[model samples]
Every structure is written in structure tokens, then in C-alpha cells.
Target chain A: MAEIPAALLLLADARLPAGGHAHSGGLEPAVAAHAVTDLADLRDFLHGRLATTGLTGAALAAAACAYAAAYAPDADIPPSGDGSAGGRRGWRGLDAEADARTPSPAQRRASRAQGRSLARAARATWSHPGLDALAAEVRAPHHPLVLGAAAAAAGGTPRQAAAVAAYGAAAGPASAAVRLLGLDPLDVHRVLADLAARMDEVADEAAAAAAGGWDALPAPSAPLLDLLAEAHVRAGLRLFES
Target chain B: MGAHHDHDPHEAAPPAGRALRLGIGGPVGSGKTALTAALCRALRDEYALAVVTNDIYTTEDADFLRRAAVLPDDRITAVRTGCCPHTAIRDDISANLDAVEDLQARHGRLDLVLVESGGDNLTALFSRGLADLQIFVLDAAGGDDVPRKGGPGVAQADLLVINKTDLAPLAGSDVARMERDALRVRGGKPVALTSLRERPDAPEVAAWVRGALRRARGAAAAAP
Candidate 1:
């Protein structure tokens, strides 16, 4: 049997203790308010999240990581040593674009939190200077960006990075449903397995986005989800953070 | 709200990376906000301070702090949970974590972050991953028997506070009984009575936080 790399296993382990369990990724509010009820509704929710929020942000993050990693080995990249790669005005532009595209403060906070956590974990577990450099650039890194950078540092391909991002996104909501709706854990696993089986499709979407380059990247649209998120904020009693 | 100024003025400084985040949680009107305000006023000069507040709808708590002029507006950020406050602080803390880092980026020398959860029920408690120390607040107006009910927040918080002692006389609450019951459930962690309206000093609570912050900073410094 071919041996699996330890880094891959470490990155894939859901229980690695990076603190991913607490968030429902906005599903709790959707479920409690009947925005998402059963398997069919959940499938729609996951698909929407994947297409709009998940795909665009995850792809951008992967691309950013790749860009940073590609420039890692150059000794004279720039002595600014500020992790901005020679005061690359272009990087600042990219950061601004990301800030503009993400309208929901709640969503922005969630992405940044996950990014920082992933970066901190990667810094401790891996020996990649590029990942550390990327982490140092921003106070709150976006999750997809950090995940992409971490994957590169860990030697996983962009395809693998997308797979991890997609899986993490899907798994959060499915687990939340299991707890909120009292669905069997076995049933939640089955749903995740089904989603996992389609990783290639998800990865392809992410890769396509990466290939298009950051300037031409497609913007995601899920107005209903955004509206639901806004509504969830005002809800008096809810089980999830939108 | 003070001007939004970066507390750490040094450029490209390495992350200090100290501080243990402690979350303060309780039902609405239970004095979580008041307690947080008190802590900021008490601890700011001694320890580098930052705050993250989860509000269900508006940025009320953050706004309140800013208005009170306890901390700079930038140091106190509001996360509009748009859902359940628990999810942001406990379940999915990505947003809260981001808020913390943003504060750290602007003010890199932080020694403590106080996370305030939206008014929630007894079941609400901070996830261990998000908060090193969790303080659960119960108001005397809620009822004397609340501590005996033994929900997760009541039973598991690092420190449990019976607040609104000033209201206890009018509400006819047994503050001593509540303290005993809380002690019985918490297995000797610690419990304090707070009258935010009267005793702004809140020496006992402040002392507990000072000790917890010291221990948390020590642990962080020791991390490999």
C-alpha cells in the first residue's frame, strides 16, 4: 500500500483541535427559522454557499497563497520585510477588492477568524517561511486565504486546497443540523460522505477560478443567503451565527 | 468613543501573541455588559486591553462602551451575530477571532481580550477554544434559585457572578443562598456578588480577572 503523507493527514483530520466545531457557518439561523429544514433544503443551502461564498473566496485565497509561495525562494524579493513582497501595490489592491466584495460584516469576521486560526496552527505545525510571511501581512487573515497558503506550505496542490475548503464549509453546516435537528450522527456522516464524493467537481470549480487569475475571478451571488444572514442577526433566539 | 487609533504604533512589529481571551456571558439585562464596562475601567491601565462584543441586532454593547469612553472605539468591536450570539462566541468563532486579530493588528501590545456574549440562556457557555476563562452572570432579579438550576453556564463557567445585588433587597432575593448554591454547583471555582449600580469598584471581580489574566499570559509565554 502506498504510504499517505503525514501533512495531508494532519490537514484533513477534523479533530486536529484547530477549533472548527463551534461555527455552523450560518446554518443554525437558517434551520431554526425554517430556512433550511431537511436533507433536501440542506442540499440547496450547501450548494448555494459553495457556489457564491465558498468558491470565490476559497479560490482567491488559494491563488494568493500560490503567489506568495512562488516568491518565497527569492533571496532578494525585497528588504521591506513587511510580508507585502516589495511593497507590492498590487497586493494592497487585491486586499481592497476582497474587502469591497465581502459586504456582510458577520461573514467578513468569520472568514478572518478562521484564516487567523488556520495560519496560527500552520505556523506551529509546518516549516514554511512563505506561510509565515503571508500570516504576518495581515492582522486578521481570511480563512480561505490562510487555508490555501497552509495547503501550499504543507505541499498540497491547489486542487487539494479547494477540496479541504469545500469539505470544511460543508461539514460545519451538516454537523450543526445533526445537533439542532437531532439527526443521527451516522446520518450526518452519510451526508458528508456524499458531499466528499463530489470533491473533484468542487476542486475543478476552484481551480477554474484560480486559472482565471484574481482580476478576472467570478463574483458569487446568493442574495437569499445574505438576506437570511441579516435577518438572523436580529432574531431574538437563535442557535447559529449567520 | 475615542478616536480610532492603533494602540501599538510600531510598524511591522512581530505579534506579541500573549493574552488569554476570557468570555463574559449571561442573559440580557443580567449585567454582562456592565461587568465588562467595569472590568475595562479597572484593568485598562494595568493590562493592555481589547474587547469583542456579540450583539444580536445592533452594535449596542460596543456602542455603549464607546459612549462611556472606557476604551477607544477601535479597541471595542461589535460582531453582529445576525443569528444566535452563542454561535459566534461558542460554535463558530471565526468572526470573533477575526475581531480579536484586527484589534491586535491595530493594537499589537494587547494583554487581555474580553469577549461579551449577547444576552443568552443558561445553556449558553463560551467554547473552551474561544475563551480561556468564562464568566457567567445571573441577576438577582432572575430569581434566587437560578444557580441551583445548574445549566452549562451556571455549572461550568470559570467564575459565576450573581449581579444586581443592589436590586436584591427590592426583589427579595436570597443573595447568600444563591452564592452557596453557585459554589455547590461550581465545585469551588469562585462566585462573587456584583452591584454595578452601587459598587463600581467591584474589587472581588477585578481581582479574579487580574489573577486569571496573569495566569493566562504566563501560559501563552510558555507556549512553544
Candidate 2:
């Protein structure tokens, strides 16, 4: 058993009210497409998501947190504090990388949309220069990157950021699954508990990958999630944003 | 309709930086969307305007506004509530705030912005963070006793609208008792009865909105 940062739990709480409740992270369309029907199918769905999109998102969060934790306010700029100019460039580069990895137009929009909402709440909550840099630099950052920055602002490490990101990737969709499928909430939690060990392994992998710098971060993509996200937007009746 | 002047004087004007936000809220099938469309159509020529619709599962409200063509298509944005309409308008307003800011950025200084809530229960009310003023609608057909059973929506909203007055006779709902009960629970907050069937343009409601805008600007002007 390893010690965890208290802030990590705070960041991972689905009840944080950062507007995440509106997004199903491709679960709605997956349910609609009948790719996820019963609890067993849900188990497979969570596993696949935890591996591909979850891992990639965790790596991005780790990288963003690392960037923020290492922020150095420039001695040169006084009031304007373009002080974060270097960090701004780093955030921009990472955002571009996120864009490159996101294959679907709809998924990209969803990522940015969630990111934008997270930034609004995070900037108010932490008031950190690194968050300022992220906001000043990018039009709209990706969801994982913003989560990582928020995690750092709340005094978390890159690994903790990775853990929270990976947790969100699993937890959000699991919550959505309960609502969409009418599964017993306790049964869903058991499925998530079963994935707990795997979640940690991926978080470790993401933190290690992030240490190799921006380009070395994981870029694993999920084609079905992307396809489903695109389908969800065009859906006439849907309960989720993604 | 402008003669009804029981607004809360303690309600100060919004800060100078943004447009005046008005929230339209009500129970399911309560004619909230109809009121929003009427307001837009009536006021678009009078003021720079835009709207945001908080929809539970779909973009139906936003789509209706677009189809009506009361305002330009770009002026309307729909926010999905993930099934909790009240949360979007009240507890967590990040998405609605973003939509409002985006509309302002794109369209410049809008005199009024309407944030219409997804159909919800009688207890739902917009948070002050989201709307400077709020209108709660109830269908006469829902039940005459709804007004007597005072919830936050019926009691505290800036305006309470009893809609579908034309159906009162067929539905056996008494508009007079509804109004009296509303007056009792509200302690003199304004209430209006509307029949969209006869006045499709919603003249009285539109007039009420005009009076609201006037006060918002008047307070803004009076402030130092």
C-alpha cells in the first residue's frame, strides 16, 4: 500500500462540479450502439477504455502537471508577467500534440469544451501562474492537460496527476454507465474496484513516459471511441455531451 | 403589463462588463420555450439579443429557436444538462457562463441574453450567478393548486407566468384562484397569466421583459 496525496482524491472526486456530469466520454454512444449492454460488456468497455484513451489521457495530464510544477516566473517581466512565457510555449506545444492524437473532429471539440470548463474552475480555485500560462497560450487546452495543471495547482505531483486523469477516464464513464444501463451502482463500483490495480499500473507508465518529455508521452488512440463520439453529436436524442 | 412593478429593489444591476442575463424556467410542458421565442421575436428589433437553451438530452430548444428564425442562427447556443437542468442553471454554471461569454465575444454588446432552462420541476430556480433575473412558468393545465403549493420557483422568481389560460375551461383550472394563490405565496411578487393561443406574440410578457430591461439599465445608470 502506497501513500496518496489528499489532493489526488479531491481531483478524482466525480462530485467536484467541474461540469463533468454533462459528458459521458463516449459511453452514451457506445450504449446506444449496443457495444455495452450488460455488466459484463461494461467490464470489457471499461478495460478497453482504461487501456487506450485512458492511458493516453493520463500521460498528457502527467506532462501538463510536470510543466506546471516546474514553472519559473521570469525576473524580466513585472506587471504583465509574460513571466510564464516559457511555460506558455510548452503548453501550446503539448496542446498541438493532443490535437494531433485526437482523430475525430467531434472528440477534439469535446476535449476542448471540457478543458475550457475545467480551466474556468481551476483558474478560480488555484490562481496559479502555470494555469495562467495555459490559458494565455492556448485557445482551448485539452481536457487531460487542464486536469494535470489543476492537479499541480492543488499541490499534486505528476504521478498523482496521472492517477487522477486515469481515474476520471474510468470513473466518469462508469457513472454514466450506471445511469444509461440501470445497472446496480454497487455492481459498477465492483467493476471499477476490479480495475484498480490496472489503473495504477497505467498511471506509473504515464508518469514514466512523461519524464521522457513531450513527444515521449503515450499517444495510444481508440478508433471506436472516436467514431462513437462523432455519432453522439449527430444523435437526435442523447443524455450526454460526448 | 409594465404597470406591475413589484420588483425587488435590493436586486442591484449587474456589473458593467457584460450583458443583462435573464433566465426562463418552469416545469415540463409549461410553455417556457414559447415565452422565450415570443420574447426574442418581440425584442430582437428593439435590442441586441442572443439566447442559450439548457436542454436535458437534446438540442431541441435551441433547434426550435433556430427554426423560428426570431434571431440569427449563430446567436443561439444550446447547453446539455446531462439530465440535471437545475445544476446547469444553479449549482455549477461553468458551461452556461462559457456559452454566455462566447456569445458576447462573437456578437459584441448584447443588451439582453436569455438563458432558458430545460423543463424541470417546481423547485428549480436559476442561480444569481447565471441570471440577473428569472422568469418561472407554470401551465394552467398542470394544476390550479400548484401556485398554492409554493415552491421556490413560485415564490421567489422575479416573475411567475401561468400559461395556457385558453385551456383553463377545458382543463377545469381556475385562473382567478391561481392568481390569488400566487399573490398570497409570493407576498406581492408579480404574476402574469398568458394564453399563447390568442396572443402568439406574447405582448404582455414582452412588455414585462421590456420593463425588466429598463430597470436593469436604470440601475446601471444610477450606480456610481
Candidate 3:
């Protein structure tokens, strides 16, 4: 078995100060709508979300890991960084792909907002040429792309990046559910533990799909999530951004 | 996944710019929003300013500021806290930082930017990364004993405002004891007693804010 990067732990931790705490990963709206009121409904929601948004985000992160792995900080690249035109175009294309996958405008905004926050934290934590290149290309790179680049910066493989992405997809909302509903936190952990194997499976599938190239990355859609995100924006009283 | 990690105690100060960022935080109904509005009313004519409010459940704070007409509509922005107000202000200040930067970019230059936190507990305090100067407000009606409790806000905030002084008599709370306890915990930091309903302009707190702005400006200028 290959050794895992220690820095992957920091990437996976929810307390990295990257602004992930402010977002509910669509759980806020679900709770507000009474779609998820208890632990049982939460389990179902996580399962479906993991299968759809989780998988898509994981695949994108894996693809982004590939791009970031190719960046060599020691290389005597052009001062313009933009002069590495191919890399610039590549990152932009990946960001656009992420936008394409997210059908909800509100979700896209949230993703990009998170991406922007993660970009700041990632750059401050690691010195990776790919991160700077991506930042130059897209001011607010997609969250998954930043995760993937950060993973690569931390010496993690595409698979590890996918794992982190998939875990966050469910964990963010699970934590939010605990806070919003006052559910037993112990039971929430049990639910996350039960989904561990499935999360690994989704990450594996995403890592496998990543090899097919960015254009061929997963683009799964969850129409209900999209509608929920939009509805969250219009909510007169909301505790979450999306 | 459950292991605890110690956050760095030395928070890097944000790059000094044209504006001085002031953070106001305290418990619900402690008048953080009101103080922010009062500051806006007092300082808008003197300085190019804007406000960012962290609203936990609604945009009521932002809406109230708008209704008060202290600053123009575009000058105020609201950030949702996702039910964890402390996290937005202390742990992960990205959303608030985004709003602040957006305001600065829009205005080109601002003299002061007030970031009002969502009403939270005494344990809540602003991150040094988010605020150049922080003020923690406490209402006299909440409990005079609260200052004696001395959480991080009371102990570390640059300024402590013991507000709603007029209610002290009605609530049977001792205003002098609140100030004494707060000062005792604060290690000589300035504490102001305010009655916004009576003064309306928050004269003492606003004066303290003006002093803070001056000291911040002087520090920024002195930095090599």
C-alpha cells in the first residue's frame, strides 16, 4: 500500500479556515423545507447527495489534481505566468466545466465563492505553481479544482483528492444538519461512519473517471438540489448563503 | 477526523490599506447593529465608510441599517452566518472578507469599514485577521454580572461598550459594577457606558472609535 500524504489530513479537516463553515452544502434549504427533519431523512439525503453532487465534485477534483501535479514551481516559467498559455487555458476550461455541471446559479455562486476562499487558504498554506496559475486564470476557481490543486500541493494523489472532496460533500451537510435540527451529534457521526465505504466507492469511481480527461469528467445533475438552492436564495430568512 | 487542532494564536494582520476595519460583536439585542448604525450616522460625513453585517437568521440587521438611512443602500452588505456566528467572524472569515473587499473595490477608497457580527454569546470575538480594531458590546439589561464572567470578548476586545445604561435602574443591574468588572478583566482597555436611546449618536463609543481610527492610521503609517 502506498503511503498517504500527511497534509491530506489538513485538506480534509473542516476547520481549515477556508470558509467551508459558512456553507451548509444545500442542507440548510433542505432543513428549512422540512425535507430532512431527523436522522433517517438526513441519511437518505447524504446518500443521494453523495451519489450525485459528491461524485461530480470528486471527479473534478481528481482531474484538477492531474493539472496541478504537472506544475513545477522550479521551472523558469515566464513572469507573465500567462505566458504558459496552455496551462491558463486548461484551468479556465476546467472552471467552465465545473460551472456547466452545476445547474443552479445560486449553487454555482456558492461553489465559486467557496473556491475563492479556498484559493486564499491554499495559497497561504502551500507554494504551488499550479495554484498561482489557476488563480491568475480564474479569480475564483471552482472549489473542487482548488481542493485538487491543494491536494497535489500537499503531495496527495488524485484518489486522495477525490476522497477529500467526497467526504466534504457529505460531512459539511451532516454537520449543518446537526446544528440546524439539534439532532444528536453522536447519531450523526454514526450515519457518516455508515456511509464511509460508500464514500470510498464514490471516490474510487470518480478517480477512475478523472483519467478520461477533463472534457469527459462526471457531470451528474440533481434537479431537486438545484431547485432547493434557488429557493434558498429567495428565502427571506436564511442562515446559509446557499 | 475528531482530533482537535490548535489554531495559530498569531493571526496575521490584513494588509493595511485606505480603510481601517472595525469589528463589533456581542450577544443578541446587545445593540451591535444599533451601534453600527450610530457610528455610520456619526462618521459618514467625516470618513468614506461602509458596513458589513453578519446576520445569523435574517437580513434584519442590514435591513435596519438601510431603513435607518445612516449610509446609502450600496454602502451596506449582509453576510449569512450559517447559524454559527462565531465561525464567520473568528474561524472562517472568508465570507466577511469577501464582502469587505468587494465594498472597497466598489468604492475605490474607504476610510473605515465596520463589520458587525451576528448576535452571539460572550465566547464569540472577532478574528484579528478580520478586524484591525474590535469592540464588544454588552447591554446592561442582559446582566451586570456578564462582564464579570469575562469571556474572550470582554477580556480581549479593544473596546468594551456597556450599553443600555438607562435600563440599568429598571433591570436592577449595577452599571458601575459592570464597568468595573469589564475594566478589571480588560487590563486597562477603554470601556464606554452608553444609552443609545437617549444619546442616539452613541457619542462616547463613537469618540472611542474615532480614537481607534487615529491610532490605527498612525500605526499603519509607522509600519516599515
Clashing pairs in 2: none
Model 3 Cα lDDT, one tens digit per residue, B1-224:
00111121222233567688889999999989889989999999988999999989899999999998999999999998888999999999999999999999999989899999999999998988889778899999998899999999988887888889999999999998888888778766778889989988988777777766666677678888
Better of 1 and 2 by DockQ: 2
Query: Once model 2 is optimally superposed onto the true structure by TM-score, how far is the C-alpha of residue B125 displaced, in angstroms?
Result: 1.6
Task: Estimate TM-scores for all models.
Answer: 0.65, 0.93, 0.93
Q: Among the candidates, what TM-score does chain A have in each?
A: 0.84, 0.91, 0.93
lDDT tens digits, residues B1-224, model 2?
A: 32245556535467875788999999989998999999998999999999999999689988988998988999999999887799889888888998999999999889999999999998898989889989999999889999999999998888889999999888999999999999889878788889887787988788878887888888788878
Q: Could you give the candidate ranking by lDDT, starting with the highest?
A: 3, 2, 1
Tens digits of per-residue lDDT, candidate 1, B1-224, equal: 01111121211211237456879999989998889999999999999899999887567788899999999888899875544677667765666776777787898778888999999888998876678678899999789999999899998887788889888878889988888888778766678888888887677788878766665566556767
Write out the backbone clash pairs for model 1.
A22-B91, A22-B92, A23-B91, A23-B92, A109-B95, A232-B82, A232-B83, A233-B82
**What lDDT does the true structure give each of the candidates?**
0.72, 0.85, 0.87
Which CAPRI tier for candidate 2?
medium
